[model samples]
Target: MRTYLAARAACIVFLFSGSAAAAVSEEEFAQLRAEMLRLAERVGVLEEENRELRQVAEATVSEVQLARTEAQEAGRTVEEWAPGTTFSGDFRYRYEEIDVESRDIRSRHRLRARFGAVARLSNDVEIGLRLAAGSESPVSGNTTLGSGGTSKDLYLDQAYAKWRPFNGAYVTAGKMKNNFYRPGGAGLAWDSDYTPEGLAFGWSGEQLFINAAAIGLESDSRRDNHTFYYGLQGGARLPVGDTVSITAGAAYFDVPVQGESSFFGDADDFFGNSFNCTDADNCAYLLDYEELELFAELTYSGFAMPLNFYADYIRNLDADTYDTGWLAGARLGKASAAGSWQVGYQYEDVEADSVLALLRDSNVGGGGSDIQGHKLFGSYAVARDWTVGFTVFVDNDAGENRTGSGTDYDRVVFDTIFKY
Candidate 1:
């Protein structure tokens, strides 16, 4: 019995000690689990921070690349905006000698000088201006003016603004040469010797082109009281092929005459009688006049010798008359060729009762007998920007009129031009 009791006691003690050790071990395991959970949370936070930093770095890199691309594109655009800006000018000096067979005596030598400037103001605009100084010698006569005078009267050969607002439309204003007839010598026929201040508007599209304007006129001895001269013109250019073009145009002018009397020897005389009538009864005897001009031209640039043909008709509304003229010409020169030449023949027919009759009857030897004229011109490129040229002009009446005698006139001109 004693042995059994001792063994039982020892077993009880062992059970208690084992229970205490299990409790302590459980506590240590709980602490270790807590530490492991904290470590995991810290590692998760670090991972999140790394992901955010990577996103930020990627965003910054993308922004920098975009900026670089935009800068390069802007640089390319600037280069294309203004392809070229060029400066160019020209100088022309002409010496003329004249002999009038009808006047019996010859005139002195005349000198002329002209300067011009052409500039590219912008991608769509161009500007030009010119200054000329010379004696006013008639193409056929021995009269010269403004020879020894001051050069203060510098004419504005071209002071205008041009804009290409659309793909095929252009507008210009401020004292430009009028576009009346086709772009040829005939087109320049009515341009004022002195530049006139005016406004011109033009429109051009794929199939059509039209230009119109109104201008101011300077009063002269003939029409001393004239306030303004207005004109309207329209033109159309049609392309027949890659190198040929046909153009047609019409022009009208309205002029008011005041101050001075008698139509003879007056510039306004071509329109109608210049008699000032204070009473309606006297005004009934005067004829009101308006002038109309119609013109057409054909240009061919495909051949070895480019050819141009022009025809024009003028009608006096009140005088009930008409005049017709035509010109056929060719330019046989190349910009890179050694020699260049231009030859033309012009025929101007004026009836006995036409407006040109007054100029004919003034003994200016230009009227009344069906005037025919011929022109021969040639030019040689002595240097890159220097050229020398000569021209001869002759006019003769074919002797078809029985009431008036025929007249004949001849003229020769030489020119030298240098440009840069």
Candidate 2:
């Protein structure tokens, strides 16, 4: 446009200056007009190029804005779906052998895998879900190896929500982790893998802790009564010396089972609890369980490796006889680092009707009551998050009713475990 205006101004000046126009020849005038035409053509071309450049710049800006908007939307969607989520998993492989008094020694290979996710919904609330390799057994999670290479089952191991209303106080509901204390991991009353379905409450102070739970035992709409288990425990830790500490606690459990009814749809599931069977489907518990437990642990950290001595005792107040169970053990060191190792030895005597047979340690005394045994276990961490362990159980029947009565029972387990 500037060149076009300049060309027009030159023509106007030539036309107004009559002397200058007359002095120029016709040929010169024609050449001047041709030059002016060329300048006009150049201006038109330049304007077209500028128009294309403007359009290209606008399109590039539009694409950048669109990409920015899409990226922000994606971030918001991710936040809604995955707020503070974390994943955890562990796997264990085992070789086990069980020998009874007169029966053939049984050997098997087993594997257990567990995967879980926990998400934080808020500062005060969180939820967890876990899947495990196992059947519907409440006390065991091992999947036996082999059956024509059949696919294994995956059970819902945990589905729970936890809410912490304040510091050191929390509530949990659903199929949740056990909140009750087990001194030195003793399985006299509860198994490690037994996740209960119900509600649990806990409070912890600097030197004291308390736990309570209301668990659902059996629920049947057709029956008039449903069974439930309630538990409460409180404990305190006291320092006796410079490197010595003692922890002591007491617990109470009430289990009221309806008579003349089968639990878990199988009378054989009693696992040595005193019961009378009327038929294959109808059985009655001999006694209701009102249990009182006293537990204590003493730890001395004066040595290079800490020494822990613990004892657990439970008595069923409702039963007349065979209603007591006890365990005493000592552990040295801890298998927490790559080069660390630990060894433990415990002696257990569990009589029939002492505790619920179905909930006690499954591997000890081959799964439940009427058993007295010694358990020795050791573990070594070869690397971080990886460990190998061995456990041996030497047990015998305390009563004549269980299989292979008055005979020796032994079980050996070798395990390799990995965690992430």
Candidate 3:
């Protein structure tokens, strides 16, 4: 543009100089100069508009690239999903103390960690798996806090599939988490750590629930006998008023055996140095049982905090003797969220055959049946997904008068737990 302007100036100078001999008109020179200025201004405006168009084009290209990259990332995520899935679990550090009637005293520190995941095959079907830091301890999933040089044991705690073919119905199979609700979250009927392997069906509605399961408890190859556990439970939940609600359930469980039912909570042969039934070492036993358990819970929300009162009763119709168990408690607060505090107290009288000795709450007289105790517990959520809790059990054998009855005991547990 500058060179063109300079050439134009030179031409005007030459024209004027030449025109001097012809005595040229001044108006023609002025008109030519004005036309040059207008042309330069138009070119400048066009150049600026062209630059803006280039910038707009570049921006559009950038947006296209970003969209392509996001699409690729979304494809990768879907390809990795087996349908779709979520993962969750918790960990806890526990300190325990057990003193038996001024005689036997024991203390231990333990760690319990478990992780699980669920993958949806569709809205109607899903698979779940839980892995834990312990062996096959059916009633306690804790690993002792020591033995550093030794390899830790990790077990498949649960591997199951749940299917919902219709509204308010679920069918589950394999070793699965308990589907029954215990009044006041009591551990009397089913231990906290017990996961039964079997087939189960459950249904829930606005005010009613039903659950049933058939569990394979044990197998005997020599005698070709099997122990099967069957259970059915139905319950109703009702609101009494604007500030109160009540829930109740009736349950029946039958654990029948061909002969001696020995597999309830007996230590595994590998750990307890006892021969399994399959072993040739002459190990055989039996337990025959059927239980009718009733449970109830009442909540009053009108208090400063919610107050929950709960009770459970169970009787073994097939036990030879001492076959009754019941518990009652009241809890204040849910203790589920951060900054929440909760306290609860319960008293239980459990006979030897009332509930399966091996599957009852381990904290009650060291997880054995034929025990009576007051369990007091409290918890505080110190942070999100973390809590500190303590539980005290003042327990004694219900059948202490009988020969070979277990001794009396008091147990305390302090734990710091984490969940995510």
Candidate 4:
């Protein structure tokens, strides 16, 4: 439009002027029109480029938004479980050999499997359940290979509720795992499989720890026949320096029972054909022993591997006969981290009626109180949360005066375990 207006003005000036000095030549008008055409063409090209750029920017934003949505959907798929609810368990395969003195030594293959889940409501309260592969036995969770059983059997190993009402304090009840402290990794006083049915509590400070519990061992149909077990333990952990620490504790257990219907029954079969009680039905009574135990452990980390030296002593406070037992051991390393290894050896001398037979180490001398043994064990963590382990027991039945078995009874166990 500007070009047309300028041309009209130029024609008017040429038509009305008497002098031709200001008149525009035809050639000049033609040049001006060509220049205007070139300018308009450039503007049109710039406008088209701007439009294409806007479309590209919109498409890039849409693609980015789509990617973000897909990422959020994938995250939701993995966030299915509620917070504080976790699942974990382990499975073990074992081959065991039981060597007896002056008798036929037997060997067997066994297996153990466990699955557990825990749900936490808050920092103070949680509930857990566990399913284990075994019949209800205090000491043994092993399933014998080729038992000809039609179906696999599983038992509730642990069903418990735990609460921490305050700092450094806890309460647990139901058929829960043993809450008592084990001095040297659990073989001395209680079997690994022995989950106690009771209510237990613990309170701790910076260095001092206290524990107490009351457990129902056997419940009779008749009211008075009910049996109970009670325990109280206290301890302290003291660090000497950067490399040395000591842990010591004293514990007392009161078991009040005497009858054919003993604590959990002799199905544990700790006693052979000759049991202390003269009952006809497979020695059904459990020998009542009130135990008082003191234990101390010393750990030194100034070596290639951490070293722990431990000693545990127990006396049956109520026994009129044999009344004392002790165990000493040392272990190198914990064998917990991947590719780490551990080895340990323990010597145990337990007198008859010195400790409760129903709950002690089942693999050593058949879980009897009248036994002495040397236990050697080694373990290696092969992969993450997996381990291969071996244990050996060279024990003898030592009744009062060591007259029960002059011969040796040995046992060996090899196992591989995987945990998650």
lDDT of 4 by residue, 264-292 (tens): 55443543212344544444444566889
TM-score for each of the candidates: 0.57, 0.81, 0.75, 0.77
Off by over 4 Å in 2: 1-81, 223-225, 258-260, 398-404
Pairs of residues clashing in candidate 2: none
Order candidates by TM-score, high to low.
2, 4, 3, 1
User: How far in Å is the alpha carbon of 94 misplaced in model 2?
Assistant: 0.9
Who is ahead in lDDT, 2 or 4? Answer: 2
Minimum summed lDDT over a 10-residue window in model 2 is located at 396-405
Name the lDDT value of residue 49 in candidate 4: 86
Q: Write the per-residue lDDT of candidate 3 for residues 1-420, one digit (tens) a residue.
A: 557656766765665575652564688767765676677677678768878999999999999999998898777753375448888899999998888765767898888899999998898999999999975778779988777657778999999999998999999998999888889878888888989888999999999999999888764456443667899999999999899999998999987652543554343322111123655543443345688999999999997779999999998887666778899999998667779889999998887667666677777766656677788999999887899999998854544523455567788899999998
Best by TM-score: 2
Question: Which candidate number has the best lDDT?
Answer: 2
The C-alpha local distance difference test score for the whole of candidate 2 amounts to 0.86
Provide the clashing-pair count of each candidate structure: 0, 0, 4, 0
What lDDT would each prediction earn against the true structure? 0.52, 0.86, 0.79, 0.79
